[model samples]
Target: MPIAHIHVLAGHPRPVLKQLLREASAAFAQALDAPPERLQVWITEVDPELYAIAGEPADEVLARTPRAQAEIPLIRMALMEGRSTETLHRVMAALSATTARVLGGDPQRVRVQIDHVHPDRWAIGGVPASQARAAELARRAAGQGG
Candidate 1:
């Protein structure tokens, strides 16, 4: 499972927020080989006055550079450990690409951070994720999709 926490300056309309969630989930599902059913997304909107860039508040930045608003989406993703470095890099790139496509931001400005946690530290239904991962791998090895 992967959880993406998106932070943005407050005051986007509902539709934009909805699209962010939808598009980000699809990006993770496709890029990380995870099912959408296991993807969790959370959006946190910070007050413009509380967010700053290069020592200026969001409103000040916007006043100085209108395009700064489109560059404000910050995403933090948490995933299970044990994935290869190539997989992580691919997912990060895909996430940035999808975010730019969905939000019309400059791809260079899309910020993404991924944190990998040991599966033994995560659990579902009292079973550690490492155990679940083993089972899932066995299923895959046996020609059953996990």
Candidate 2:
């Protein structure tokens, strides 16, 4: 299964996130050769205070720049459980291309982060773990989360 974990700031509206998510899932499904249902994607929409862009303060950057109106701090992570690193890169490339247009921003600005996690180490709908670590993908695992 290819799991894609996405963490985005709450600055954008719901629809944009939805678009990116759908595209991301499709990207993973195609790249990893996994079924849509088997491809797991977890999205964490954090408050602006909780997210940062390129190491810049979220609120400050948003407040000072007009890009904030159309641009959001986005972090996309793809996990290739039982897959190859080459496949993960291809997935990220597709995700960035589709997501930038979906979110209405320069495609170059979107950031992609991919990491691996264990099924037992992740949790959702409950305090499975700290938010910091809750956003990783695992291989050879059941569904704890993405």
Candidate 3:
């Protein structure tokens, strides 16, 4: 499963945010080989006073540069480590494009943080994901798991 945490200054319409979530899920499904249903997306709307850019609050930044109001979304993605650098790079590119399309976000202003966690550091149920993943891989190789 891939978990995405997105933060943006509060203002965009709910429809836009919904579209963004939809697009982001699709992007993850395609780029990470994760099932769409298994993807986890969390959007956090931050007040302009709480979100700062370049040492200035978002509101101040926007007041100083009106044209940049729609450009400051930040996306953070966490996934199990093991994927190749090339794959991660592609995921970031796809996500950035999807975000830009949904919100008309500026490519330069959009920020993405991808965190790859070791399987041993994560868990599902009571078992470490490293063990579960190993078993799953074994089963898949034996044609017993999907």
Candidate 4:
């Protein structure tokens, strides 16, 4: 399974946020070669007063700069380790483009961090993924042919 957490400043329209979730899930599914039903993408909205940049609150920063220019979104992705570097790069580009297109910001302003966890370190239903998802993992390794 792959999970993505996108952090953005609060106050964006609900429709935009919903679009982000839907599009981001599609991006991850296509780039990571995972089933869309198995992927999770969520948004975390933060208050401007609680977020800071360059020692100033985001609320103050946006007051001086246009919201579109100043808003920066942080995305964190967690997945099982073992994907090729090419796949990782592709997912990053896909996510950046998706964020920029949906949120009306520069793609460069989007930050993505991917954490590849060992299967043994991840759990499903209280069982280590390595043990619980062995057949699924094998199918994935075999070009998703199963």
Best by TM-score: 4
Off by over 4 Å in 4: 144-146
**Candidate achieving higher lDDT, 2 or 4:** 4
The order by descending lDDT is: 4, 1, 3, 2
Candidate 4 residue pairs that clash = none
Q: For model 1, name the residue pairs that clash.
A: none
TM-score, per-candidate, Cα-based: 0.86, 0.64, 0.86, 0.94
Runs of candidate 1 exceeding 4 Å displacement: 68-70, 137-145
Per-residue CA lDDT of candidate 4, range 1-146, in tens?
78999999998999999999999999989988787998999999999999997789999998898877888899999978878789899999999999989999999999999999999999999999999989988986876732
TM-score of 2: 0.64
> Model 3 reaches what TM-score against the true structure?
0.86
Alpha-carbon deviation at 10 in model 4, angstroms: 0.7
Candidate 1, residues 24-75, lDDT tens digits: the string is 8888888878789989987898887878877777877776776544446788
State in Å the error of residue 17, model 4.
0.4
Cα RMSDs, all models:
2.5, 7.8, 2.8, 1.3
